[model samples]
Target chain A: MVGTDTSELNAARAALVEALVRTGDEDRDAFRTVYRLTSAKLFGICLRICADRQGAEDVLHDVYLTIWNRAGAYQPGRASPISWLATIARNRAIDWRRRQARTRAVGVEDAEAVPDGAPAQDDALLAVEAHARLHHCLEGIESRQRAAIRSAFFGGLTYAELAVQAAVPLGTMKSWVRRGLLALRGCLDGDA
Target chain B: MATPDPDPDMTAAELALGVLDGDERAAALRRLVAEPGFAAEVEWWRDRLAALFADWPAVAAPAHLAARIEATLDRGAAGGAGGAANDNDHRWRTLAILASIAACVLLAVTTLLMLRPAPLPVRVPVTVTTPPPLIAAIAPTTKGAPIAAAYDRASGVVRIAGGVDVPAGRSAEVWAIRGTAAPRSLGLLPARGTARLAVPAALRGAMAAETVLAISIEPAGGSPTGLPTGPVVAAGKLSG
Candidate 1:
């Protein structure tokens, strides 16, 4: 979260807000322009999570139509329009995540046009802190519980798979994962 | 020991986070949906997941994609152009098809009558070979309308052996009986000699079918009113 300002974020935010505000009977062209502008980037976010280009493109198409229809529902000041739009993209991706089979592990090589970049010191530190917080929060949990949560969140492994990996019973792995997530949520709430 | 109370809807957040799997995940989502509070928690998880993807960089869209969308919009805007063209072609084709069918029906009726199973010899009226001169003998009763000559139905033919004299610039015209409407033009009669006219097969039924076959004489150009203007020189039954 270091050096993340409200102002720079607000620039992307303002464009979307203005677009929604100006979206009326006469502004169909504006809506189309916005769709053309944002669809590719939004598609990228969906593809990363879905790991299927076709599925990502479908979600992207749906998201734009939804945005066009619901533009009047946009409330500025609560969140930037771009942020709102991004939220829409991400939710669609997450909805797709559960449907995708874990057997298909998407290689990074298969992803199109992923940028290679050196992580800035501040960005890397923030990422490290987030990971550390997650680890520290799991420190008090039993090994089985921690393993269950990690398998679910990062590995995309099902409880049955996690149980097999941990050499534990499936039911126990499920209970551990569920309870572990609840406990972690409580701990994260405290940190906030 | 107290009974362990099972929390049915507690896993909704997990389901929303994609933490549940198979039947368990399905049951969790269903239960969560059943309980309002759990559903709200799931919604929260959804929003949280949504927020994370906001960090990704926006990519520029490909030009061809916009073109494709525009093309789709254009095709829709043309209002069923492809279907309209198909229907127009289909309409003309249908009309032509119907006309051919009508002509076929007419041909079939004539063929059926000719091939009647009994093969009874039809009696036809024969023309009198020494019939009186058309103008002097038959003109008054004809009321100046062209004479309708009767023919033999058995013979199935008509041969006009003589012509009536009309004043110069006036031509004798022939007609086939076609009921109450104006008569159909057969052709021009000779000024002072015999003229032959081929009787049409459909006209075989003219007299018996209660159809009156009459002819009218008119100016050289034919009847403008489509009715006779000249005297009926000769008249007879078409049947022989």
Candidate 2:
């Protein structure tokens, strides 16, 4: 919701949540509205993870269809509506990437990999309240955990993949993420 | 549901963070649905982790995607997606997909039927293979229907292509039979042409040069009993 003012953005956000709720009722019109408002953002996430436009398109299509079938399961509480939709897109993209990777001759994940700042490819500003909290807490944790968490979430990687890419043991990678998550929760909870 | 573990298994968190793979991923998925506390924890992890991606730079999707999805939705609403030929030729394109994915098994009659089933999400690839792939040409026994299946021992993927029309309110379950051994259910076949089935690891060994493959008509979800409870529509001996 690239609105000029906070009030307008809030209204657009509410509109999306309402539309998603209506989508549960099998309203095609409301589903279209949901698509119109969120497809671009979700498409971008899929594109980043899939690394292919056509594959991303196919993924985006599956994501929306999943939303259509699962809208009934969405809860207005617990999380932001946008966050909820974003989770579906991310999970779908990750699953798509994994399936393709497995089907096309499962290969070795390179040992000597690029550094952890690949997310720097996108310079978009964080636009939600949780964004600041997450970023702040992320900064508070150890750099290794922060980087591992970042790569795991954005890069759609598994502990095994992350371990191989970083030339570390799988247990080490898991420990980093597990400890980081506990620390992140404490930090965020302390703030809340 | 099992009481929320005392020390909180971080699987929910790992799942939310998208790092769990293979069995761990599958287990988390099962827990996600089976436990409310775990599910909420997952939602929590989802929200916090997803916040890291809130401002994914927006990119316009192709104009036709919405229409294509609408068509798929309509088809699903009419009847589920597979089994029927849709208006779009995408399925046909998928049917014609030829990527000589390597590995082999029982060979003779299954020679290149060009039995290409569309690539589907259901066919999970197991692992790399070195042995030759096996092809089973399942012909009708007592009844007349043509079905072809290719079994990759390495990957445990059984790609069944061709039509074996299922009677309404019933599903077609593929069975692997060897001699007097009881038929082992591979999985329910697609209502129409060309679909891949991942054979359970326990049943993968059942596929050999002379194993007999059969298809049976059962209740929608497959025979309630482990054994085929319906009539065998097609059966044949697989040859090398």
Candidate 3:
């Protein structure tokens, strides 16, 4: 079962990369193939950060359009295809939140109320080895630092927002996140 | 005294975490395009941090989303000739001819309007105020080949039909050159079938009449030195 799952994950990753390359060639069918394979994951990222279905849908539309134009710039060796796609989704969602912030305030209580623990379905489509490695590394960090990192990533909140929500000084929050990230990087690099 | 450079690793980590504000984020994006070393650093952070979201639950998007995306693509294609058809060489050739004639007509009308008396009420019947899209037919260095290529000015894209094969262990890179200027890289070309390459914004103004477009075979990831360090296989000029 373990072998099958690893192979399947690798196959899915390869298929996604191939589809993106084909889309670069302006193959409409390949574009459709890419959307079918990855839209769910991207939409989930958008929805998580945007916190609204309509906003997520709009951001998802822009994400695929960007993929259409920028697929040629994708280098397979630099990063996994899903990571690249997720990066774009997250950036768009964050930008949406930033734009909305000018007119409406994001409720600090509501954003902080989200549970920081690992979700049950966390490794469903991610590489199992990488997931295990990250979980292990995260355990080495303080709980507050870990929660701050998770909340910032999943909620697309800025350092200031994170600080306000945690009821900590802004500098304290920044140091916690920066130190946490550095430690996490050291651990991940050591494993490699 | 000059300001000290910010820490690259810290900046990359902040960017990867999505904690940078608007202006900071914009500056990071500019660096990602113009400074490749910085780009690689950013990519490293992204790859490392991506594992944090490995367990994000996958929620299926609305069923209509795919249809909506397809419709948007079709609407965009209808606006320009570049994305209209992939396999039809004849259609592209026809577009090139029409575009050429339109260019000539536009030039003639503009010249006539300039020379005519200011008070003349003679209104030209042409509604086209913009120059027709420049195009080119890329020809291989060797004899007749099935691959057809054209650049559409309106869409700022180079459309390649059919296939161009590179030898094993090599890749195809596209470059655009104007007059005596040095060739600018336009990214890599696909090995086969149709591909639409948007003209990079930095090089958009150079896509004019007399400019040359060429494809060279390079190492897999592309030319490492930013210059074409490979043999040119096919070349052409924007004709109209």
Ordered from best to worst TM-score, the candidate numbers read: 3, 2, 1
For candidate 3, write residues A42-128 as lDDT tens digits: 898888888878879978987787677556544555335676677778877876665555546767554554444563343444666
Considering every candidate listed, which one attains the maximal lDDT? Answer: 3
RMSD of 1: 34.6
lDDT of 3 by residue, B1-240 (tens): 332543224666776787766456555544543354665556567666677656565789999988877776787675432232232234234333333323221122222323445774756558855556677777777766735666776667778775457777556888776654446667678776687777643356567788777777654545432445456677778777
Estimate the TM-score of every prediction. 0.44, 0.56, 0.62
Model 3 misplacement above 4 A:
A1-4, A72-79, A108-110, A113-125, B1-9, B22-37, B79-240
Report, for candidate 3, the interface RMSD: 9.3
Q: Of the pair 1 and 3, which is ahead by DockQ?
A: 3
DockQ, Cα level, model 2: 0.22
**Candidate 2, A20-130: lDDT as tens digits:** 878878899999999998888889888877766887888788778767765643434422566556766776677567656645633334212223332322323234566
lDDT of 2 by residue, B124-217 (tens): 4576336678877787655565667788788778888875777665567787865444456676776666877766544555678888777776
* DockQ values of all predictions: 0.07, 0.22, 0.27
lDDT of each: 0.47, 0.64, 0.66
- Model 2 misplaced regions, further than 4 Å: A1-5, A72-79, A105-127, B1-9, B30-36, B80-240
